[model samples]
Target chain A: MPEQPVPRTGASGVIHDLGYRPYDGPRNGSGTIASALFLSGFRNAFGLGRSGKSKVLPFLLLALNLLPAVIIVGAMTLFNANELPLGYARYASATQILVSIFVAAQAPVLFSRDLRHGSIALYLARPLSSAAYAVARWAALLAATLVFLLVPIVALYVGAVLAELDFSEQTEEAAKAALLAVLLALMLTGISGLIASVSVRRGFAVVATIAVLLLGNGVVTAVQGISDEQGELRVGEVAGLFSPYSLYRGGTSALTDELFLTPPTGAVMTAAYFAVMVLVGIAGLAGIVLRYRRIAGR
Target chain B: MEQVIRTRGLTKDYGSVLALDDLSLDIGPGITGLVGANGAGKSTLIKVLLGLVPPSSGEATVLGLDVIRDAAAIRARVGYLPEHDCLPPDVSASDFVVHLGMMSGLPRVAARERAAEVLRHVGLAEERYRPMGGYSTGMKQRAKLAQALAHDPRLVLLDEPTNGLDPAARDDMLGLVQRVGQDFGFSVLVTSHLLGELERVSDNVVILDSGRLLRASQTRDFLDATGTLLVEVIGADAQTRMGHALAAAGVPVQARGGLLALDPAPELGLDVHDLIRDTAFDLGVGLVRIQADHRRIEDVFADA
Candidate 1:
């Protein structure tokens, strides 16, 4: 083997040739690749490993999201209320603008940047399939959204515990809220990730996601208000099915003490609400996979 | 000879375009240059070999693994550096390579070690920690090369490794590729449209034209000296004088870029080298040198 001298910097610097050693060690399979992608993608959503400037938006949104929860806890202690002021399930519903903005702003960080920069080609060239890449990215977004939704619930639970509220009641409500948060996170990740993946431009993706989420919610809220005024309970409930937030509200109202303006009342409507939620989530995930498969094929 | 890549009438067709048209090849282990112009199906062939694109018909195998049925297995053993930009701008080369090494099945710690080694091998050790967005074109290509080698595969397919580099950097990159094949014990199938760039590094050459196999041969065969001599002389008007004198003496003489081309006539049994020497001595000019003219890869393309 030829020894090429390494470039010298300082006089004290030492160099070694350590000739190339072939790696015959054991290698993990596609499962490991997908998991690594998931881990990296999860960190990226919160701007971890990214520039400090990039970290500001997601974290600022999180701080704002938690601000109301902290105040509710403080207010509960000061007023000596018999119970927590915000129901566990209703916390996300009331402060959903922050949640919507968080998912909208961060989804592109995980999805749009890779496709825009053509780095997804690197992942597809590995042992991992394009479907696995899409699924891993969606999983990362879902996990991040879950963290966003769960932090406030935990804070509220701590506050309620210290306030000496009924332990069993608070536990059940927190558990139910946790379950609903999972479902909500699934749907949010699916929708936002799909939008971000479809549009390669980051700014365009963020705006489109915000439009789909907030515009859809705004129109549904208007319909629910008019329908409630008209005393058409069926119209209001059906309009609630049109938006993800409304669906979550309908679920919490049906399953918790919090009341929504138009909750899915009957067994049939309630089942449809839950079914649609899961279906949209699944469909959005499937769309992202198909999109990536097309890119890989090209 | 054991083959590193083999294809039996492989073909790929997009309804409007046929990317690979009935190409059959046997590429043995070593450094082989896949040469073609932009639309000559080099990238398509690399994709098929890596199992990213399935063939419309026929068969191909890499490292003896079927391209269709055992695509994932083939991918595990073969590394690919795509022709286009494939790096994430925000991630450092170290992190990107380490992550890709893990993606190739190495555990985290092993991946890190391998990444460091490969980055240094590619001469990116000093700049490995900087974000790729701030990298020079040469640095970016080196980082890409580092990731491809991080997994230590048996074969590496490099698509235009020196695409945007200046001449000096291109020379360095080609030298590294030669080392990868000779010193590092990896079979390489590198592609380039520039004909002469691969001549110095490749053991064999394959030329493609409009999705068709144009030629494949040993690089030495393409560079073999033909039965002609290139004569150079010193002094003003010496070349014109030599051309006239040779032609007058019934030798087929031509001027090729300031060098006098002499096709000796064996029928007359004239010693052309001796004649040129005496002519130069008689003309009061100096004979610089007389050497055989060898064909270049560019000549092969021009002949086609």
Candidate 2:
């Protein structure tokens, strides 16, 4: 066998053989679709499915949210079989509030890690555009948050059906609760994910997410509480469009069988609020992605 | 004759700080060494080529695709090994590489196979299944290299691959890097601040200082000799006496190590062999070694 040549370390050998070539494999679909799907898979594989540390708190929050539903059923079955409690709806409302808080707190970790670690550089070097990167990250956050919000809500609905015992009535009530939970979860996840993407630091992202979730509601509540007018339309319906928590509260209230506060006068206003809030959240997320891309480039 | 990465007046700014100055460069394939001190914008240039960061000014193309317009296309074909420790602590090297490979468009089965092959190649097969958090610095660097190669990219951008490693580990990593570019035929752009080290492995060297190109040339040119003789011998007061002897004999000599370094003086028509042998015979000292001192590129830079 011929003796192999030793590898050259200096530039003389390298300059003549600048061996870079463009990839000639399957182009696929302009990269956006593939990148989005990959990001989704990455988030799913790692976020909810991988670690005990990541999953525990979210699951615990879900369990806490469902605690009231379990308590309500237990009280009706084991304690009071005749009439429902005076403030049964209020306990359900509290569940929505708790889920909102949990989602807001966790969303920052999803967006901040990629930026801090420079892994985002690796991803962008692929055929994925900044827009696609943003969408994928946002999708991951939404999906993870949805897992936290949906599981307990579904458990509560199933528990509610078993508690009712009357098959026909149970089916109708369970369907209604499921629909309400899905809508609430979507609103919460979208808003939290948007807030989280606004900054690269986890601390800032978390603070911004929580501010949108809690302060937005507080502002609306303060406006409603001080107003002396009768049938004054709660800003929670309109201003809630600015915050995920408010949107969830308003949507849940609308879906409930009992009318806790007078229903917003028009369904159109509620629909408009949801639509506007979602668009704003998405736009905010887009801004964040563009800013990050610029920063990373530098 | 293909340019893997070409840039024209590429610039990047961070607030008031210019991270990358107006840089015009042509990066061809194979293992091209990018050498610069810390804060010379090596990382910035790599990030821009990857299309992770948009330039403040100028244009660049990687793998024949416009860096800005065809970023995703470029990224899909390129692999990157970052300088810092960024692996997820909870995931095993095999799992992470496989996941990244799949994300780059390989099917699940293919990704797994590629991940196994890459991990084995990087000498991490025994520990591939272990979580990265427990890995030593060498192991972590190997794991990072494994992930970058897992997708079977056409080119790899390695940022200080030998960073945070012992001398033996650094040599091993450099050897692996050379193999990846030569044996596997993938183009590599590897960065380092240690010029001499890269001169041992890189075929081409691009030197940068303060975000400006100092020199870009073949490694041989940088290490070529300037025709100066270095003489070493064993005796009492070797360098000092030899220097005095050479000076008295009308030859210029400088004391270096255990040797008397002689500058090339054309006018004297000096015979280095005769002079050394005669000096050793007269002094009754054994001659050890006498050879020309090959000037390194860094030495040239220092002279400049």
Provide DockQ values for all models, in the order shown.
0.67, 0.26
User: What is the per-candidate TM-score for chain B?
Assistant: 0.92, 0.92
**Tens digits of per-residue lDDT for model 1, B1-304:** 8899999999999889999999999999999999999999999999999888999999999999999898888888888898899888888999999988998889999999999999989999667998999999999999999989999999999999999999999999999999999999999999999989999999999999988999999999999988899999875498888788878888898888878888757876878778888888887777889999888999997788
**lDDT for predicted candidate 2 compared with the true structure:** 0.71
Cα-based lDDT at residue B184, candidate 2: 82
User: lDDT by residue for model 2 over B1-304, one digit each (tens)?
Assistant: 9999899999988777787888999888888999999999999899888877789999999899998898777877889998887787677888888877766767667777778878878899678888777899999999889878877888899999999899999999999999898978989999998887888888899988888888888888888877888888876476567678777887778887667788877667878679878987887777788887876767756965
Candidate-wise lDDT, in order: 0.91, 0.71
> What CAPRI class is candidate 2?
acceptable
Q: What is the interface RMSD of each candidate, in Å?
A: 1.1, 4.6
CA deviation > 4 Å runs, candidate 2 = A1-49, A67-92, A156-182, A198-211, A215-219, A222-243, A253-256, B9-22, B55-58, B125-127, B163-169, B245-250, B267-270
The TM-scores, chain A only, for the candidates as listed are: 0.93, 0.70
Best by lDDT: 1
Report the C-alpha lDDT of model 2 over A108-224, residue by residue, as the tens digit: 656666666556655555565666667676666556555655555455445555556555655655566555554555566566666565566777776666676677767765554
| Stretches of model 1 off by over 4 angstroms after superposition | A1-16, B245-250, B268-271, B274-284
Report the TM-score of the second chain of model 1 against its true counterpart: 0.92
